[model samples]
Target: MRKGFLKNRFVRVKLPALLFATVTVNRGLMR
Candidate 1:
C-alpha cells in the first residue's frame, strides 16, 4: 500500500512536469 502510494505520488508530480516540458519543447520547435 505504501509503495503504491509513493508510485502514485511520483506520477502525479512528474507526469505534469514531463507533459509541460514536452509542450514547451514543441512550442520552441514551432517557433
Candidate 2:
C-alpha cells in the first residue's frame, strides 16, 4: 500500500515536469 501511494505521488509530480521539459526542448529545436 505504501509503495502504491508513493508511485502515485511520483507520477503526479514527475509527469507534468517531464511533459514540460519535452515541450521546452521541442520549442528550442524549432527555433
True-structure RMSD, every candidate: 1.3, 1.2
Q: Which candidate number has the best TM-score?
A: 1
Q: The CA-based lDDT of model 1 is what?
A: 0.98
lDDT of 2 by residue, 1-31 (tens): 5999999999999999999999999999999
lDDT of every model, 2 decimals? 0.98, 0.98
Worst 10 residues of 1 by lDDT: 1-10
Please, what are the lDDT tens digits per residue for candidate 1 over residues 1-31?
6999999999999999999999999999999
**Clashes in each model (backbone N, CA, C under 3 Å)?**
0, 0
For model 2 the TM-score comes to 0.89
